[model samples]
Target: MTKLRQFSRNLAKNGLLFNLFILSNLILSGCTSSTQPTYPKESIDQAIQDICKKEYKTDVKVKLVGSTLWIYLPIPEGIVEKSNKPEKFIERFVIEQNNNELKDEIVSVNYLIKPVPEQEKLQDMKYSKAAFDRINNVWKVLRRVIFSMEHPEQNSPKFFVTVTADTKNGFLIKEIFYYPDFKKVSYELMSWGEYQHRAIQETEVSPKIIGDTQGLNLKYSDISFEDFILQQIQHRIRLKFQKPEAEKNADIDKEILKIIRYTLKAYGFKDFSTLELNNLATVRKITLNQTAVFSGSGD
Candidate 1:
């Protein structure tokens, strides 16, 4: 009788363990199946092209980088030449895509349309490849550094900067910056609720500021100190300028360095020696002597 009772208990224990093993296997399989790529690359590419062409009347080249898709559209030479407003492109596209069907299909999307040289010709202006290249390199690095600092745990963050130049009115330059919307991510639970890791979409975080000939004369009150620091790091000056013709005799690279020195001096940084200019752009990492306060009024 005692032996039989022991055997019964052992069998029940083994049955419970076996059932748990089966349940766990099922759960693991479900998770794996859920993660399998459901969106085909070809379908996404086709959809983006079709939607962009039909809606915006523009042809786009699609490139898939990891889970995000990049849509590159060349600016129409006519539009860039005639319009003094390149900032309109940023505003128009954001509104167009807000309720579009494409937004639902993709985890993230980046639309890039850098100004073309043909547009410069239309404005009777010459293209400064050297100047533009320097600007591009600086903006790229600045964006990367800032994003990494902000989201240290995030492995891959979607972001891009669009630089547009309009020499029609004293060498106007517009920069449109975009990044993934991190603010929407939720971290709260109810009494009888389950937890979830919410997904977020790309959004425009910074204001689209246009830098022109007047950018050289920007005052301390015109821009926030923090933003000023970033612009210096990116080599993007928001001050107004006189004219490209005035700068024709000046060495742009040297002028940029002078501006950096002047700006740092205003911020009360005596150690200007720490500032370094690489082959492409100005790069610096400095710790302030005091806590810097960013003004609310400046762009």
Candidate 2:
């Protein structure tokens, strides 16, 4: 009887060990299967292309670059030929991965609309070197004058504007505004294209203002000053370019200079010299010669 009891106890212990081992194996198998994601790349690509075609009414090139998917929509020649309004067609493209049941698989999606290239006949038109040079000179003058007015105490505020030709468009202008300590205050991009000459955008980095007044009176408060100057510059350029063929390309420098001076006067600064393309660097020293003459209130 004692031998039989010992045998039964041994059998029960072995059976328990075997059951525990099997349970552990099943648990590990389940974890491994769940951790692996099953995402069909081809299916996702096809889905995106189909959606884009339906939305834009045009075909798009879909490319998966690493974790990000880039959808390139070339501006359809038919659309451009039929419609002259580019802004109307420039709709913001948003792709919701969760709605498409791809939130767990795809990392990011990008929509890139290619710029409309000038027609072959239009491309044959020779770019005006003289016009480009004049525009560039005026831009430099504007930059120098604005820098001087903004930082009267600092000498040679390191301001620069670069104008370059765009292959598809016309001209690209990049302007940089710098601080007295030689750091960048703001950067702006303006495009002088065949269709439009306008301010594209401006980006600025917030500067750490060191002063006793803590919360309200910060340097960021005067951030709009740069934007105001840029807007005036763009406005003058746009007026020059957007005029009728007979009035277009009329002496831009004189008009731009007059506008700048009038704007400065309105803002209570009269000592600023009229910006001349040749004498841009000469106006490094600026003085506030008057107080607020116009209250900017309409009668």
Candidate 3:
């Protein structure tokens, strides 16, 4: 009887252990669902929209082009930005402005660069507090959707651009955010505040065509971040000194150095070894070494 009773107890213990093992396996499988289909098999854009609609109670337009993902956010209320520094045109006078006797032509130039934020602190009273949250939330959704994909599309986007459109006013703002830097933010290697700051700087509060020129393609491909930055430097120079009547074109050259140094210093980008600034209109170029930029001397 004692032996039979001991056998029954052992059996019960073994059964309990087996049941626990099965339960754990089920739990483990449930956790592995992160690799599972996060969205429908139909399309990624649909998945993003559905998830955003469910999560934020909002609507967003998403388009995935070759190697790029574009998200357009609609704002019924127009974006109101603070005033920018007035452009100072060079005062030049020529009897025959179109004469071939001129050494350099003071033609208008268009830049192929997207604008970035000057500095967060400098942007006091610049943008709405809600704008930051709106931008960051959409970005977080994009990150989550991309990372959760077990198998991405063949084009698998490497670049992410978000555009905010004021539906009422028909004004649009485009921003390109670097994915590697965003991954750093996700991994906690970088702070969220810093990440958001970079994102803010990556957009334009007021974007006008090259020297406000017409017939220029406003939508441009920024091949790299450095290309974007260099274009920004060129654009700032062009906008600040748009005047054909400058006392000296050399002042534009000097302003180029000042703007480059100032803008680069403010943005905190230190990777490049050299930069060649080109005046697309004039075909003139200014080349600077890395040392020349961070040498701690006045521009």
**Backbone clash tally for model 3?**
8
- Model 1 per-residue lDDT tens digits across residues 1-299: 23223322222111222212322333334322122233343354455455445644544444444433343333323111212432111111101111101122211111121112221211222223443333333322222232334232353324322223222222222232223322111111111111010111111111222223222221112223333233432322212011111132444334444444444444454322223333222232222121221111111
TM-score of 2: 0.21
Query: Of the pair 1 and 2, which is ahead by TM-score?
Result: 1
Error of 3 at 161 (Å): 0.9
Give the per-residue lDDT of model 2 (tens digit) for 37-116: 22344343354455445643434343443332332322211100111321111112111110001122221111111123
Best by TM-score: 3
Model 3 alpha-carbon drift over 4 Å, by segment: 1-42, 79-133, 151-156, 191-275, 278-299
RMSD of 3: 22.6
RMSD (Cα, Å) of candidate 1?
Answer: 27.9
Kindly report which residue pairs in candidate 3 clash with one another.
89-243, 90-245, 90-246, 91-245, 91-246, 92-245, 92-246, 117-201
